[model samples]
Target: MSELDDPVGSSLHGPHAALARRVGRTATYPADVATFCAVPADPAPQDWADLARLVGPGGLADLFTAPGTPPPDWTPEFAMPGRQLVAPVPTGDVDPRVVELGRDDDPAMLQLATATRPGPFFARTARLGTFLGVRDGGELLAMAGQRLHPGGWVEISAVCTAERARGQGLAAVLVAAQVARTAADGGRAFLHVVDTNAGARALYARLGFTQRRPVLFRGFRVPG
Candidate 1:
């Protein structure tokens, strides 16, 4: 396998590193950060530091802790530890159960998420692209959505399933649908997950996704 194909070397290192290395340089601003998706490269060390600051210490720790940020202890083993999962989606043979949702659907989606309480990023992701979900008798069970980065890669996020609906494969089905949509649009599907969550990681692996890399964020402190 090529260097990029090595899960430990490439995927496990996080997209920022790949993006920086691809461009042979580093991004200077938030807007420029998007460019790395289009042109992969190793993020300048300082840039990564700058980014951590922008996210704030609390936000940084929260993100590193899980697929979704809150409810603390929702998925004990899935707590974030400065790592994330970036998986590739195979479009063929998608599960028909998955459906695309809209902002108008926010109340239902948020309601489902709140019961499970994935994280704050879920609300932010709904603004990016079509949010996909699986419903059961008119109730949202599991959901995932897109977050575009520089138009090159679409981050698959907000993956959460209702506690009562676990083990139905709803999360996997929604992810496949979103990934198919992303690849069909000429962009790659990527996501962030906590380092531990073996169950979720195994699901992604079954879908042919190899772990890309770990990402950590530190918050920037405000001046007194």
Candidate 2:
């Protein structure tokens, strides 16, 4: 069977396509197009052109890439850019203060994520996968989660810390824990962040992640 036929790869792609369709979006693969309702009703012509440019003249292979972003070197013809945010979880053992958030039903977790722009999607994705967090006393401070698992690759996402909790290294610690867990389970970690967020980029770099590529997300209004 071809790599695309692999169960893990197929499952990952299916979920992504489903989510996209629900939002009116469409993704193109070498063999087929995955259409999602998530795509905007009135997509700008440039949006389509950008998608074409990112996928290249030949079209996509096994992966997906947002337009205006470069594909990662390790990925094939279709490259998704924006560096995979990765960092080394502290060595030896997972910190006791860090905890794995089991489900989004927890009101506190939802509230914490809602404070950020990407949090809502992060919350939704976490429901389909796993989420990890760190706390001080009873308050949730920093958190991260898993997304887009194709083959041995797992994307680290929804990483955030409370606004008042900055400078405490809580984000670093939380990411480290997630990476360590992924590595232990024999999976590689990756993530996406807005290219303009220099501070967040620096933090990821300090933890040992390097820029893999740039990615873009153009949101359009869905026609009613």
Best by TM-score: 2
Q: Give candidate 2's whole-model lDDT.
A: 0.54
**Model 2 TM-score?**
0.63
lDDT string for model 2 (71-120, tens) is 22322322223444444443666777888886544566667777754423
Which ranges of candidate 1 are over 4 A from the true structure? Answer: 1-80, 89-91, 122-124
- What are the root-mean-square deviations of the candidates from the true structure over C-alphas? 9.0, 9.7
Query: What does candidate 1's lDDT look like per residue over 1-224, in tens digits?
Result: 32322222232134333323221221211222221111123334443344334433333222231122223322222233534455565657778888778867888876776687554454433654578888878788889876434335666766789888899888888888877887888767777665556677677777777666666432222221
Cα lDDT computed for each candidate against the true fold: 0.54, 0.54
For model 1 the local lDDT of residue 19 reads 28
The worst-scoring run of ten residues by lDDT in candidate 2 lies at 31-40
